[model samples]
Structure formats: C-alpha cells, structure tokens
Target chain A: MIRSIFIKETQLLLKDKGTYFWLFVLPILFIVMFSSIFGNAGTTTYTIRYFDADGTKESRQFMDTLAQIKGFELAADNEKSLADQIQAVRDGKQTSLLVIPQGYSQRLLGKGAAEVELHRDAAEDAAAAPVAAVLDSVTKQYQEHKLRVALKGTGQSQTGIDALLTAPIQVKDIKENVAKANPVTQIVPGYTVMFVFFIMITMIHNFLRDRDSGMVSRLKGTPLKAHQYLIGMWLPNMMVVLVQSTVLLTFGFIVYGLHLGDLFAVAAVIISLSICATGIGLMLSVLVNSVNTGVAIVQIIAMGGAIVGGLWFPYELLPKAVQWIGLFTPQYWAQRGMQDVMIRGAHLDGVWMTILILLAFGLAGLAVATASFNRFAAKAKN
Target chain B: MKHVLEVADVVKRYGSKTALDQVDVHVKEGSCFGLLGPNGAGKSTLMKLMTGILQADSGMIRAFGMDTRHQMSEIRQRVGYVPQEITLYEKLSAVQNLKFFGEMYGVNGAELKQRIAHVLEQVGLSDRANEAVETYSGGMKRRINLAAALLHQPQLIILDEPTVGIDPQSRNHIFEMIRGLKKEGLTLVYSTHYMEEVEALCDDIAIIDHGSVIAQGSLHEILEQHADQAVYVESDYITEPPQLSSIKRASARGRGWVLESEQPLHTLRDLSQLFAEAGARVHALELVKPSLDRVFLKLTGTALRD
Candidate 1:
C-alpha cells in the first residue's frame, strides 16, 4: 500500500509539467544567470607611481620595469611635477606613489642604502599592497644588476661572486591581493534561500489543495489515518525539495567552485529542512480552505521569511533588532546551516544545532497541521 | 448478511444553520435506493454524510456495520463515491485519473489493470479512455468520472448528481450502467434533484427538503397518494392548448397534454364541447394518471432550481 501511494504520488508529480520545470530548470537558470553576472574578472586595479630622482640607466630601467606589471599604472617624474604627478596617479586609479631619491645609485655603489619614499592614498592603502610587491620585485632585480656592474668595475674576476649575491642589498617587498566583494557571491546564499522559499511556498499550496479538492477528506475517508495522509502528501513534496536542493548544490560546486563540505551533513540538513517545510505546508493546508488562500498565506510568509532570513541580504548586515527578527525565520535557520557548512567547514556535529532548530520548526508545523486536520472531518460535509 | 450502509438520525449543522436535521437513511444489499430532493434539499450533504466524508454533529452512521466516524477507512474500502461536481484531474487522461484513484484505493497488480478495463467498458468509455478529460464532452467526462469510482469494484456506489449536466446520450448511458450494476447486485445510493431519475431507476426514494426527510417510500407508493389528482390525456393532439378547469395540474407532453383533474369524464366532455364550439380539430383524447413528476411538483412548491 505504501509503495502504491509512493508510486501514485511520483506519477502525479511527473505528470505535472510545470512542477518539473520549476524543480529542475529554475535553479540551473539562476546559477547561469548569477555566474555570468559575477564572471572571473580578476582583482581590483592597484596603481603605483615612480618618482625617479636619480637619472641613471639603472634607476630608469628599474622604474620602467616596475610600472609594467598588471594593475600597475605609473607616473614618470620627468613629464610632470613629482608630487602633482603622484597625486594624479592616485586620483586616476589608486594613489600608490613610489619615490627614487637623489644619489640613490651612488649610495648603492658605496655599499650604503637610502630610503625610497612610498606614498599612498589613505583610503586606498589596501589597493597599494599588490603594487608595492611589484615594485619590490623589480627593484631587487635592478640592485643585483647594479651589484654585478660594480663587481665588474673592480675587476679581479668577481663576476662569479657577484652572481652568487642573489639577495640584493635593497630588495623592496610586496605581498598582498586586494580582493573586492562580488555581488554574485554575496547573493548566493540569498538565492539559495529564495529557491527553497519558493519551493516551500509551492508545496504549501499543494497541501491546501488536498483540503480544497476534498482529496484529504477522501483519503481520510479511506482506512488511512490523518497522519498517514499528511505524510503521503508531504513526503512526495519533501522528496522533490531534496532532489531540487541537491541539484542546486551540484550546480554550486560545478559552476562557482562552492566548497560544500561534509556531504552527509549537508544532505541531512537539507532533508531535515524539507521535512520542516513539509510540516509548514501541512499546517497551511489545515488552516486554509482553498488553494489560493493557502498560496496567498505562503506567499506572505515566504516573502517575510526570505527578507528576514537573509535571502535578499545577510542578517549580519541588518540592524541588531532586525537581525533578532530575522532569527525567527526558518529561512534564517536554513541559511545559517548552509553558510556554516560552506564558510566554516563545519561537520554534521557542528550544524546539529541548526538541524535541531529546523526540526523544531517542522515538529511545530506538524502539530498545527494535525490540529487543523482533526477538524477537517467536521467541516467536510458542508 | 450485513447491510451495506445505515445512516441513523444523523444531524449536521453549518454553524447555527442546520444542513442535515436528524436525517435517517439506509441503502441495503443489492438495492438501488434513490435520494431524491430539490435544490437546497441537502441531497449532497446526505451523500457526504453517508460516504463518511462528513461527520455528523450528533447521531450515528454505519457503513458495512462499522461506525463511520471511527472506521471511515473500512467503509471507504467497501464503497465508491462520485461527487456532484466533476472533481477530476483535467490534465490527465480518463484512464490516468482512474489509475490515480485506483491506486489510492490500494488496487494493484493485474487486478488494477483488469478493473480499469472493465469499468471503462462498463461506462462505455473504452473508446475515449486515453483522451484527456479536458478534451471530452460534458457527458463523456461524467462517464469517465463514474468509471473511476467503479474501478475498484466497490460494494456500494454513491453517485451524487451523476447525471446533472449531461447530454441525453450520456444520461442514457449512465442510467444503463446503473441498471447493469443493479443486475450485478451492487447496492447504490443515487442522489439527484431530478425526480424523473428516481421514477425510472430507484426501488425506493427519500424526498428531502430544508434538511429533513419529508417523505420516504417506494416510488409506486409515493406516487399513489397523488394519483387521483392527475389525469393524462392522449390525443392525436389538439391544435391549441386545452383548457380544463378541473385540472389541478397539467403539462404539455409529446402528442398530448397530461391533465390532472378531479372529474376526468366531465373534463373530457368539456374539452370536446370547447373544440366543437371553436370548430377546432380533435382526433382523439383520453385521460391518463399522475407520474412521479407531478407528485414531486405537488410536494415542493418551487421548481427544483435556485
């Protein structure tokens, strides 16, 4: 009997063309849409300015080389005023200014070191880091070349020894990647929550339809108890939700390289969430008399849940009071589970609290649904 | 042997509005009992109650001797219900809808397939089984809907307004199916607002109105009380409407006017005199008796429509 019902429900879902499209096609479409929107464009531009005071071939060569790196746009001191030129570079892109002091070559030749001034726009200090790294690399290479020439002037076959001094006396250092937040990545969790929200809304209406069409009453009319009927309707939708979520997660991995850790825990959280959503749907069915009414109710709830649970924006960014309100949303719990699994690399044991919260939601929803269905018998005849 | 259904003093109310007021009804083994009533007469409500789809505010109901309230599933297993509205999956084929409902009823394996085929044939829907219900005509869908209920080979069939809106062909097909089921000894509780259906098929009828059973008896017996008030006259047909003062009721039927009068001979003589005085042609005329239609009209002042 259970198998027959399962088959029947499966066939029913299959026969519904609209559901098939929404369940399978929609998430893939969203993935493609967001991926295109957040295409791999590399990091932000980091501007570096060259203040060449020493007119030697070595310094000019060094200056010319450092400015050639990607995300590095330099200002030559000969064509424009040094401070003004540096200011222009900063204003044009990111103001990361580098100065080559006078007698810098003589100081290097005498086995002495002089400071090269690096000026930066305070607002763009982070953007200057990568550009500084580029300057450091090029300057280090120039210093070694200068050292090799100096050793050649001294004669006495010091070329081999000069080559051996790989570490230059002045090696400018650079190591930073100025990364910017992409709207697409930021909205992934929101989009996922939106998908789950839309699905739950759809399932909720189907649940109520059983009541409106007298399907539930008819099922109850049979030997099946209320709980069984509830389970039958709910399990089919829950299974669909699970399949849809899995497909979305797969897309996340393949498309954006979303590292969803702990497969078992992720699947468990999803299944638990689907169960909870099913319970919510059942409760809706119990409260509403018609499919449209149930849909309207779910729509309102889904919108509220989506907004509060960070489907549109992260709860962390919201005001403290709003965040408190967001915590009440089931979407919040679901999003929390997903973010934890993805961002924190947490195991199932770690997300157990989220799973429990979602389970509590499901249980509460189921309780309400049962209460409402218990009254179905009374109103059915009319 | 146990009776298929017994509804005893079931009282149902919609808020303070009484929908089924202490209504007692029964369908026995292999009997086609008609539940006849006018609109707002609670025929559908009574059917819902009988099928265990609705619970009574008070009183008791039993289907196959099991309490309907607690043992609805057992009762549902024994009976098939075709609701007043064509509550079907319109996107699916007739056979598909049947399969869905059949599965719900736990019919599986070759037995389910055989049952589907048998019912399709029984309802004269074999030719249209694969067609989507939306593509079907009004009558065809109703036939398929009935076929769905019959797929499980239920012991008791409850058809509420099964023929309400259908073509003559479909209506005739449904009546024939009911008759065929009767021959096979399947008990049925047929509810409709149409009195003629009760006259044609029911062994007995319980006429309801205002949430109560106003009358209940065999069709012949129910018609017997109002028999004297009706008189049917068959004529080669008068050229115009015939005036008979003693006619407490009259309706223009085919090839004649059925006149219900207290004095049939006098009315007949008066008809002849009037035709002679007007120089109207009258080939023949005879007084006939009352049908269930007249009996129903007499009992219910308003016609059976909102």
Candidate 2:
C-alpha cells in the first residue's frame, strides 16, 4: 500500500508543474540570492604579506609569526613591495598584510635607540599602530638582554635590569582546537543548516499551490491512506533538499578544506534533516488550504526560523534570552549539530542531544499533521 | 456470494437534519441497480454509505458478503467509485490517471499497462490517452472518469451521474458502456436524476424521495402501480398550462399536453362529453399508460424535471 502511494505521489508530483518551479528551481535561485547577500560574512579572507625594509631581527620574527593567526589565507605575490601590497588590500584584491624592513641592528648595540618602520595597509584599523608598539616592546627586550651581556663583561649587577626588561611572572598562551583549520570550516555547517531551513520552509509555498489545483481532493480518493500518503510526498521534496545539501557541502569540502567528520555520520544527519523538513511541508500542506495561505505561512515561518536559528546572524552575538529562544527552533538544533560535527570535528556522541531533540520535533509535527489531516478529510467529505 | 451489497435499515443524520431514515436496500450479484433521485434527496449520502465513504449511523451495510465498517479497505480495493464531481488530477493525462489508480490497487508492470490500455480503449479515449485532462471536453472527461474506476476490474462499480452534462454522443457512448458492463455481469449502483436513464439502463431501481426510498421495484411494476393515471383530452388547448378538473394535472411536452388524473376512466368519459358540447374538434384521444416519470410525479407530488 505504501509502495503504491509512493508511485502515485511521484506521478502526481511529476504532473504538477508547480513542484518543479517551487521546489527544485526556486531553491537554486535562492542559493544564488543568499550567497551574494551574505557573502561577506560566509567567506574567508586571503592573506597578503609585505617585505618591509627595517631589516631588524625583531621585525623578521614578527613577519615569520603571522601564519599563526586564524582565517589567514596565506598566499605569495611577486609584487614584492609594501606599497603594492597595501594597494592590493585597498583595492579589495587582498586582505591586510604585515611589512618588515631591512634595518641596522648596530644602532641597538651602539646607542640607546633603535627605529623600525612598520607600514600597514591604509584600509586596516588605526589600531595597527599599537600592534606595532607591541612589536617594539619585543625589540626593546632584545636590546636589554644585550645590554646585560655587556654589563656582565664589566661585572655590574644585571638581575634588577633583567626584571625590568622581562616580567618576573610570565603570561602563558594556550592553543586549543579553535585555530587549527580554515575559517570557512567554521561557517560551513551553519550555512548548511540555515540554507536547509530556509529552503524547506520557503518551499512550502508549493503546498498552498496544491489547494487551488484540486490535487488534494483527487489524491484523497486514491487508496492511499493519509499518513502513508504524506510520506509519499516526502520523497520528491527530499530529492531536492538532499541535492541542495550535497552541492553546498561538496563545495565546502573542495574550496574551504572543510571536514565533514564521518562520511556516514554527515550523510545520516543530512538525510534525517531532509525527512524532518518533508514532514514539515506535509504538515504545512494541511493547515494552509489555499495557495495564498500556504505562501503566507511558509514565508512567515521561513523568515522566523532563519531569525531565531541565527542563520542570517550569529547567535553568539545575541543576548542570552534570544539565544535561549533560538534553541527551541529545529533549525537551531540542526545547525548546532552540524557545527559540532563538521566545524568542531566532534563525533556522533557529541550531537546526540541535538539528534534526539530533532527527532522529538519530527514526532510532534507528525502528530499535529495526523490530527490536521483528520480534520481536513472530514471537512472535504460531502 | 449471496449478494454484492445488502443494507438493512440504514439511518444517517447530519446534525439536526435526517439524511437517510430507515433506508433498506440490497443489490444482488450481476445486477445493474440504479438509485434514482433528485438534488437534496440523500441519494449521494446513501451511495457514500454503501460504498464505505461514510458510515450509517444506525444500520449495517454489507458489500460482497463482508461488512462495510469492518472491511472498508478490502471493499475499497474491489469497489470503484466515480464521484459526481470529476475527482482527478487535471494536470495528468488520461493514461497517467488510469495508471495511478491501477497501481494503487496493486496492479503494476505489464498487467498495469494492459489494463490502462484496455480501459482507455473501452471508454473510446484511446486516441486521447496522452492528452491532459484539462484539455478534454466535458463529455471526454466523464468518459475518462469512468475509465479510472474500471482500472482495478471492480466487482461492484458505483457511478454518480457518470454523464451528468455531456453531448448526445457521449451520452450514447455511456449508455452503450453500461449495457456492455451489464452483459459482462458487473453489478453497478448507478445514480441519476434523469428518470429516462433509469428506464433505459437500470435492471432494477429504488426511487428515492426526501430521505427515504419511497418506491423500489422493476420498471413495469412502478408503471403498473400508477397505470390508471392518464387523462384523455382533445381540444384546441391553450399553449399555457390548462387549469381544469377534467385534466387534473396537465403539462405541455413534445407537441402535446399530458394531463394525469386519479380517475382516468371517469375523467376521460367526462372530457369527451365536455369537449363535444363545447364544439371542439377531437384530434386524437388515446388512453396512455403511465411512465416512470408519471409514477415519480404520482408518488412524490412533483414532475421529474422539476
């Protein structure tokens, strides 16, 4: 019976021209739309380096150390000039770069002064000057060590001066799992969840289109039981949803070097999420009996889900209360789980909570849908 | 199978209105039984209950020896229902609609294709099988509607006014199809307001009125019950309705006026004397037997067309 329902649903869906336009074609159009609007945040930045001419040992140390920063797309350019590199950043051809110069180290040993010139891209923050100051501090510490070496040659006490140059208590920097991969990996899972949510909720406009078409009354007469009939609707819709997820995820894997955790685990989550969304569409189909009503309901839910789930904006930036409310939406859980597994490289055990919560959401929706269908059937009856 | 369908004392209600009140109907095997009634007569309601689309509030409905309430699914698998309205996806073609319904009844592959081809040809829509239903004519749509029901080879097929409004060609086609189905020994519960259709097609009929079957029997029996129900009138009558006691109830149809009377013999004898005294030329006076339409009027207090 279920098999027959599936075949019938497939045939009906194929026959419906609206399904093609609303489900498959429209999602691709929106992907292009959203990729352009939120491109600034979702994209990782490229790194541009400057070969500054201060030539000091301290300057060289800082130039070599810039690779440690996160989200840096390290690239080599043959422009080989500070002015050219800064122009690149200004032109949006590249992001910010640090410049080091050929400098005379003799000034530090001969006199009590040394000057190192650091030129930043004009587009960068005015805060770069203080960052230059921090670099100067490192140079000053080197000069003092040399001075103490010279004093030891003359038999003077260097302990007090050493304490002045370097603090007695040192600050330790701990490196954990955050800065290990490209920053695009950080946003990929979030984008997947957000896009899926947007596409699913927005695509429910198709359900509204069905009402005026008289397709609902037609299917009701078929031997397809309503529940199994609903599941039949899920198949074609999930085809489009799964394809969208696959396209975006595969792009992430190639371009951003994003990890998908386990192939099986990611696939499992994607498939389950597709099922959940299809069920959501089915439920929406029941409540919104008219095409206009369906469109209105879907638009309202899509925008609301994106807002609450922090798809357009990050939840971390929001206040505590709003973030707590965000947790209630299914998009939030799926997004969180995707982040946990893909961005953070967490295992399946890490997202058990999210999975369970999504399952509950699906079950609850199914129940509501079943009840709504009973009402719909009774109402349509002559 | 003792009988295809049997309903014993079925009563259905909607809120304060009684749709079916103590309606008992049984359809025997290989019988083309028609339940004839007009709008708001609970004919559709009774058909729905018998087909397991709705439940009888206070009675039992059995189809093919099994109870309807308990075996609705099993009965639905074997019973085909074509609703009054065309309940098919308009975007799909005739063949696609047939295939979808055929597959729903567990028909697939070569067998499914064969059945679809067979039914489309049976309905004389084989040439238009690939055209979308929205593109078909009203009569063409009605034909495909019947074809969809015939997909599973149902033991009992119920059509609610299969050709309600169609061209004469489609009407003849449907009449022939019914005759063919009857010959093939399929039990059909056909419903319609056209009493002539029942006369031409139905092997047996249950004349329904107001929420109950007022009369049920063969065509000859119903006509015989109201046989002494004709007015022999000859006159230069007015084109308008004649209001007189000699013609107790008179109406114009087909170049003549048919006036029905409770006392046909006395009314005809008085009509001859009254028309002769009035110096009228007696054109043609014949005592006509009552038809199903007259019987419907006599029993229900209204004409079939009204």
Candidate 3:
C-alpha cells in the first residue's frame, strides 16, 4: 500500500509542470547566477593610479617599493594630471591616487620627513583604507633608509648600522587551520540547502490537494492504516528532495569544480536535510487550514530561513545575536555540514555532530507532524 | 435475514454542534437500504460512522457483526464506500485510479487486473479507460467514482449521493448498475436526498432529520403509514365546485381538480356523481396512491429537498 501511494504521488508530481520548474530548473538557475557573481576564490587585488612628479632617485625607489607590495597593482602610465586623477577618484573610477611632490627626496634628505599627498574617495573606504596603509608603510621605509645613510656617513660600520636600523623584534604571520574562503563553495551549498526548503511548498500543496479533493477521506475509509498512509505520502517527497540535492551538488562539481570531501558524508548530510524538509512539509499540510495560507506560511519559512541561515551571506560575518538565531534554523546546520565537508575538506568524522543534529530535527518534525495529522483527521471526522 | 450493519443510539458531536443524535439503523444482508434526509440531516455522518471513517461519541456501530471502533480494518475490508464528492485522482487515468484503490484493499496480481477491467466495463467507461479523469465529463467522472468503489467487490457497498450532478442518462446507468448489484446478493447502503431515487432503488429506508431518525421500515410500510390517499379529477364546463364532506380537500390543479381524502374510493364515487349533477364533463379521473415524497413531507413537515 505504501509503495502504491508513493508511486501515485511520484507520477502526479511528474505530471505537474510546476514541480519540474521548481525541482530542476529553478535550482540550476540560482546556482548559475550566484556562482558567476561569487566564483573567484583567490586573493583580491586593488589598482592604484600614481603620479611621479618627483623625478629624483628617492622617489623612483619609493615607486619601486610600492610596486612590490603583495596586493597592490600600479597603473602603467603617469600621464594623467593630479586634477584628472583626483576627479577620477571622486567619480568612483579610481580607488586611490598617490602624488610624490617635487623635491620630496630633497626634503627627506634634509629634514628627515616628506609628506606625499594621497587622494581617495571616502565612499570607497573598504578599498581606500588598505591602499592608504600600504602607502604609509612605504614612505616610512624611505625615511628609515635616509637615516641609515646619514648614520653610515658618521663613521659607524656598515654592518652595525644595518643591524641597528633593523628593529629588535620582528612579527611574521603564519596561517594555521585556515582554509581559503571560496565563495563558490559557500554559495553552492548555502543556496542548495535554502532552495531545498522550497520543495516543502510543493509537498504541502500535493497533500492538501488530496485532502481537499476528498481522496484522503476515501483512503481513510479503506483498509489502509493512517501510519501507512503517512509514510506513503512522505517517502516520495523525501526522495524528490534527495534527488534535487544530488542534482545541485553535481552541478556544483561540474561547473565550478567544487571539491566535496568524503562523498559518504555529503550524502548523509543531504539525506538528513531532505528528511527534515519532508517532515516540515507534512506538518504544514496538517496545520494550515487553506491552500493560500499554506503557501503564505511556506514562503515565509523559505525566505526567512534563507536570510537568517546565511544563504545570502556568510553566517560568521553576521552579528553575534543574529548568529545565535541562525543556529535554530535547519539551513544553518545543513549549510554548515556542507561547508565542513566541501570547504574545510573534513571527513565524516568531523561532520557527524551536524548530521546528528539534522536527523534530530527531522525526527522531531515528523513526530509533531504525525501527531498533528492524527488530530486533524479526528477533527475532520467531526 | 441477517443484519449486515447495526447502529445503536450513535451520537457524534463536533465541538458545540451535534451532527448525529441518538441515531439507530439496521441494514439487512443482501438488501438495498436507502438513507433519506435533507442536506445536513446527518445521512452522510451516519454512513461514515458505519464505514468506520468516524467514531461515535456515545454508541455502538457494528458492521458485519464486527465492532466498528476496534475492528475497523476488518470492517473496512468488507465495505466499499463511494463518497459524495469525486474522490478520484483527476490527473490519473481510469485504469490507474482503479488499480491504485484496488491495491489499497490488498487486491493484487491477476485478480486485481481483472476486477479493474470488470468495474470499468460495469460503469460503461471501458472504452475511455485510458483517459485522465479530469478530461472526462462530470457524469463520466461520477461513474468512474462508482467504478473505483466496486473494484474490491466488497460484500457491502456504501454510496453517499452517488448520482448527484450527473446527467439523467448516467444517473439511470448508475441506478441500473446498483440494481444489478442487488440482484447479485451484495448488500448496499444508498444515501440520497432524492426521493425518486429511493423509491426506485431501495427496499428499506430510514428518513433522518435534525440528526435523528424520524422514520425507518420497509419502503411500502413507511409510505402506507404516513402518505395520504387522494383521487385526482380533471373536468370542464363546471360553474360551481362540488360540495362533499367526504372530500377532505378539493383544489384546482392545472385545468383539473384534485380531491384528497382518507377514503379515496368513496371520495372518487361521490366526486363523479357530484360532477354529473353540476353539469360538468369529466375528462379524466384516477386514484393516486401515496408516494414516498408525500410520506417524507408528512413526517418531516418540510420537503425532502428543503
């Protein structure tokens, strides 16, 4: 009996064009659009326009130092005037502009200090702050060089002067336990988990359709038990969710070269997530009184869970309080589990806790849904 | 005859409203029992209770001698129910719908296939068995709904207003099919607000109103006990109406006169002589027997449809 119901449900869904659009087409569209926008996972670089007005050796050396900084790209030409460059910055074209004033080298040599003017748009603060800090470091190095030369000329040994110029303490950064935060890796799983939740709408709609059409009461009149009926209705939708997750994951791997660690663990997380979605769909079908209300409630859950669960952005970047709320949504755990496997390259051993939590959510949802369904059926009899 | 179904003092309540109030009914084996009532008169509720789709709050319902509450699964296996609404999967074909419902009753293999084919043929939809129910006409869908109920070949079939919203041809087709089932010795519980349908198809009936049974017995007995006997007369060239105390009531009816009375024979004899004396020519005169519709109206003080 369960198998029969499952087959019937699957066939019904297959005949519905809307289900095809949501299950296959919409997820692919979302994945393609979001991946293209956030596909680059490497280090980001900023371009700076520089005018070398100081035609001296010290200014040339300072320009060379700026070129060697790790994430700074310099323009090929100094042809644009200072006014033009500053206008470009204000117009949002140029991120930052640097001008080495004439006689800068002479001033540094004579008074040990020379200021180079830096122009930037305040609105581009995210890009402008990094450029300003790098320029400051470069000028300070030039001032140190001038002092070292002056001290060497005063009859200190060259090696001793070089040693004295170097600071007693040096700080070097060694990255530990950090993986590259690839936006593609984060987005594919995040949106996949979020969109899988939308499948609940279709599930609930089918269940309610059966109820409104009187099929449920007819089935109830049969020899089939309630538990068997519920299982029959639920299993097919859960399978659809699982298939949808597989399709999205495969699309991620083929197009974006996403690396998923431990294929078994990935499957486990996805299956658990599908179970949770199915349970939620069942619960909604029994709880809501009408189709319109069911659709409204499902939209709220899907969109709200997507936003709060960090499908649109990284959860780590959200406020501490919001992060606490994210933990309450199923998307958080499912997305985190995917991230653990795909981004962190952790195996099943690392994601077991998240998988367990997802299963618990599924079980709780199923329990509540079953109880609500029993009550709804009883009420329907009355 | 053995009783196939018995409802004793069954009471069902929904929150503040009582849907079924102390209802009692007994359906004999291999007999067509008509549940007659107006809309919301608890006919559907009573049928659902017998099918074990619902539980009574304060009574006992037994189907095939098994308790409906505890042995519902067993009871359901022997009872096929056709709900008032079209309960079929409209997206699926006739064969698919029948096959699905057939399997739910644990019918499978060659037996299930044969039964599906037989029911489709029985409902006169064999030629269109592969078409989706949504594409079929309303009458055709109603027929298929009946066909689905007949798939398992249960001993007792419960039909709740099965002919509603169907064409006359299809309604007659359903009536014929139901009569054929009765001849085959399958007990049936037919619920409807149509008095003609009950008169045509049912052997025994129970008229319910306000959640209780107002009348129940053999169809002939109920009609005899409650319905009035009257003689209808059609005449022309009458200047004054006839005056006879034996005539309980006399009124013009469509270019004719109808005289109703308990003693219809004496009333008819007196009306003929009176029309002769009044110099009126009798075009037609006949005695009309009591009908179930009149019986229902007399007992409920309202029309069957009202």
Candidate 4:
C-alpha cells in the first residue's frame, strides 16, 4: 500500500506544474539571480569621479598613482566644474567626488601638506570609505619617501634606512578557503536549503485535498492501516524533495561552477534535509485545518527560516540573537553542513552533527504526525 | 436468508444535533437494500457507520457477523465503500486511480491490473481509462468513482448517493451494474433520497427521516403496511372535488385528485357514479398504487424533497 501510494503521489506530482515551479524552477531562478548579482564581489571596481582643477604635473602624477591601485578605478570629470561635481554629491546624485585644488604642486614641494578635497554623501559611507582609505595609504607612502630622502641627506646607509623604515608592528593577512569563499558557494546552497522547505506546501495541499474531497474517509474504509497511509503519503514527498534538491544543486554546479567538496557528505546532508523537510510537511498536513492556514505557516517556515537560518546570507553576518535562534531550525543545520563540506572541505565525519540534528527534527515531525493521524482522519468529510 | 449487516439502535450525534437517533437497519444477503431518506435525514451517517468511517455514539453494528468496533480491519477487506463525494484523484488517469485503490485494498501486481480492466469495462469506461478524470464529463467521473470501489471485489458494496447529479444513461449503467452485482450474490447497501430509485432497484428498504427509521421491510410489505390506498380520478364535469361519503381525504395530484379511502374500490365506484350523474365525461379513474412517496408523506407528513 505504501508503494502504491508513493507511485500514485509521484504520478500526481509529475502532472502538477505548480510543484515544478515551487521546488525546482523558482529555486534555480533565485540561485541564478543572486549569483549573477554578487558572483564577482571581490573584483568589483569602485569608481572615484574627480575634477582635477590643478591639472598640474604633480596633480596628474598624484591622480595616476591613485589609479594604479587595484579595485579603485579613476574617472576624470573634465566636463563638470568642481563646484558642479560637489553639488552633485550634495544632491545625492553621486556617492563621492574628488577635487585636486590649486597650489597642489607647491604644497608638496614646500613644508605644507598637499591636501585633496573629497566631498561625499555621509549616507553613502560604505561606498566612500574604500576611496578614503586608498587616499590615506598614498599619503603615508609620500611621507615615508620624504623621510627616506631626509635620512639619505644625513649620510645613513641604505640598510640603516631600510631598517628604520620598517614599522614596529606589522599586520599579516592570510586568506582561508580562498577557492570556496565565493558568492556561488553561498547562494547555491542557500536557495537550495530555503526552497527545500517549500515541499511543506505541496504536502499540505495533497493531504488536505484528500481529506476535503472525502478520499480520506473512503480510504479509511479500506484495509490499509492509518500508519501505512501516513508513511505512504510521506515517503513520496521525501523522494520529491531529494530529487528537487539534486536538480537544484546540479544546476548550481553546471551553471555557476559551484564546488561540492565531498560527494558523500553532500548526499548525506541532502538525505537528512529531505527527511527533515518532508517530515515537517507531514506534521503540518495533519495539524492544520485549512489549506490557507497551512500555506501561511509554510511561508513563515520557508521564508522566515531562510532569513534567520542564513540561507539568504552568511550565518556569521547575522545578528548574534538571530544566529542563536537560527540554530533551532533544521535549515540552519543543513546550510551549515553544506558550507562545512563545500567551503571548509569537511567530510561525513565533520557534518555528522548536522546530519543527526536534521534526522532528529525529521523524526520528531514524523512522531507528531503519527500522534495526530487519528484526529486528522476523523475530521475528513465522510 | 442470512443477514449480511445488522445495525441495532445506532445513535450518532454531531454536537447538539442528532444526525441519527436510534437508527436500526438490517441487510439480507444477496439483496439490494436501499436506505431512503430526504436530504440531511442521516442516511449518510448510517452508511458511514456501517463502513466504520464513523463510530456510532451508542449501538452495535455487526457486518458479516463481526463487530464493527473490533473487527473493522477484517470487515473493511470485505466491504467496499463508495462515498457520496466523487473522491478519485482528478489529476490522475482512471486506470491510475483504480490501480491506487486496488493496491490500497491489498490487490496488486497482475491481479490489480486485471481487476482495473474488469472494473473499467463494468463502468463502460474501458476506452477512456487512460484519460485524466478532470477531462471527463460529470457522469463519466461518477462511473470511475464507482469503478474504484469494485476493484477489490468485496462481498458487500456500500454506495452513498452514487447516482446523484448523473445523466439518465449513466444512471441506467449504474443500475445495471448494481443488478449485476446482485446477480453475483453480493450484498449492496444503497443510500439515496430518490423514491423512484428505491422503488426501481431495491427489494428491501428502510425509509429514514430526521435521523430515524420510520419504515423498513420488503417493497411489497412496506407499501402494504404504511402506504395509503386511494383512487385517482379526473373529470371535466366535476369542477370541485366530488363529495363522497367513502372518500376520506382528497388531495390534488398531477392533473387529477387522489381520493383516499378505506375501500379504494368503493370510492372509485362512488366517484364514477357521481361523475355519471353530472352528465360529464371522465378522463381517467384508477386505483392509486402504494408508493414510497405516499408512504413517506403518511409516515412523516413532509414531502421527501422538502
């Protein structure tokens, strides 16, 4: 009977175009959209629109030096006056504007400071901060050069000058998971985990349809047991979620070159997540009285879990409290497990906690569904 | 004859409303037992109880000599229930729906396939078995709905308002199917509000109203016991009802008046003489047969359709 119901439900799902849209198509669309938007975050160039009022040799040299830095593209605004560019900044038309004032050469030659005016919108601080940091770095380099030249005039050796130039404290930067820390890694798994919960909606719909249409009552008259029916209805959805996740993850891999670290570990997470999602689906299918209520609850679970569980972004980036709460959601564990394997190069042993937590959640949901099965069946319209 | 089903004083209540109050019905083996009642008269409740879809508040329902409360699993294997609603999955093909139901009843493999084919042929939908039910007409869908229950070849088949909203051709097809099942010595419990349906198909019947069984017996016995005897007369000469001493009650029927009496023959004679004395032509005059409609009106004082 379970096999029969599974086959019937599978056929029904195949014929339903809405299941495809919600499970496969919509998740892939989200993955593609987010990947396209943020895939090249590391290489994205921040532009510095500037009016070189001084246009002198020194000002041009300064501008060229700043332009030499990577990820800081310089665009000379020769068409607009300095005042107009500053007004554009004030009016929020531009994030920031740079102006090379007159006497810029004299200040560098003299003992005075060579200053550049940077007019920026404070509201656009994130966009303007990198540009300011670039300018400050260039200023420090000039200062070091001045000091080196002065030491040369005092007849110090080159080795002594080099020793003096070294800073007392140095910051060393080390990149970890360099190959796996890309946007595709975040987005592919994030959307996949988020949409896995959407199977709840399909489950709710199928179960409620049976109840309201008198199918449940009719089936109750059969020799099929209640537990048999519940398991039969549940297994097909679990299989669907498995297939749905596989299709979505495969799309991520083929289209965006998403790295899946360990195939076995990924499979384990997929299996556990499928069980977890469909188990909750079974519980909600019997627990809710109406399809509208079930759908509303599904939205809260899928979308809300997506946000808090860090399926929409990196878990570390969320607020501390939300991160604490996200630990309670199976989606969080699933996403974390995927990232641990795909991003950190972990294997089955590393993701065991995730697998266990997900399985526990799935089992809990199944238990609840089992306990409520009789009441749910009783409510069916005879 | 052996009793296939026996319901003893079943009382079912939905909150404060009594859907079935001390309802009792019994079905003999190899018989078509009709549960006749108006809408909301608890025919469905009784049917559900017999199938174990519902538990009676206070009663003992034994099917095939097994208590429903304990031996439901065994009974379910022998009894097929066709719910009042068309409950087949519309998105699936007729063959697919039948296969699902067949397997649910523990029929499988080659046996399920063959049974599906048999039921499809029985319902006259063998050619359209592969098409989705949603694409079929209402009557065709109903045929498939009934076909689903027959997949298991149960000894007793319970049909709840199965012919409702069906075309005449499909209804005839269903009637033929019921008659065929009865020929095979299978017991059937058919519930409906249509008087003619009961009169045409049922050998034994129980008339229920307001959740109580008012009459139960063979077709002849119930009519002889509760149905009124009367004479229907139509005459152009007699403008008002003919005043006769033997006629007890006069009520308008189609184009005539049904005059009730202790002796329908005497009333008919008196009516004929009165019309003759008026020097008027008599269009029709005959003894009224005892009908389920008159029986219901006599028992409950409310029309069946009401």
**Pairwise TM-score winner, candidates 1 and 4:** 4
Best by lDDT: 4
lDDT of 3 at B108: 91
The DockQ figures for the candidates are 0.33, 0.25, 0.75, 0.92
In CAPRI terms, where does candidate 3 land? medium
**Ranking of all predicted structures according to TM-score, beginning with the best and ending with the worst:** 4, 3, 1, 2
Interface RMSD of 3: 0.7
TM-score of each: 0.76, 0.75, 0.91, 0.98
Better of 2 and 3 by TM-score: 3
Task: Summarize candidate 1's per-residue lDDT along A154-205 as a digit string, tens digits.
Answer: 7736757555785567777753322323444445655655666556555655
**C-alpha RMSD over true interface residues, each candidate:** 2.5, 3.5, 0.7, 0.6
lDDT, candidate 3, at A187: 77
The DockQ-based CAPRI class assigned to model 2 is: acceptable
Off by over 4 Å in 1: A39-42, A46-190, A289-326, A376-382, B1-8, B26-28, B59-73, B127-131, B231-259, B263-280
All candidates' lDDT scores?
0.74, 0.70, 0.85, 0.92
True-structure Cα RMSD, model 2 = 7.3
Q: What share of the true interface contacts does each candidate keep?
A: 0.43, 0.34, 0.89, 0.98
Best by DockQ: 4
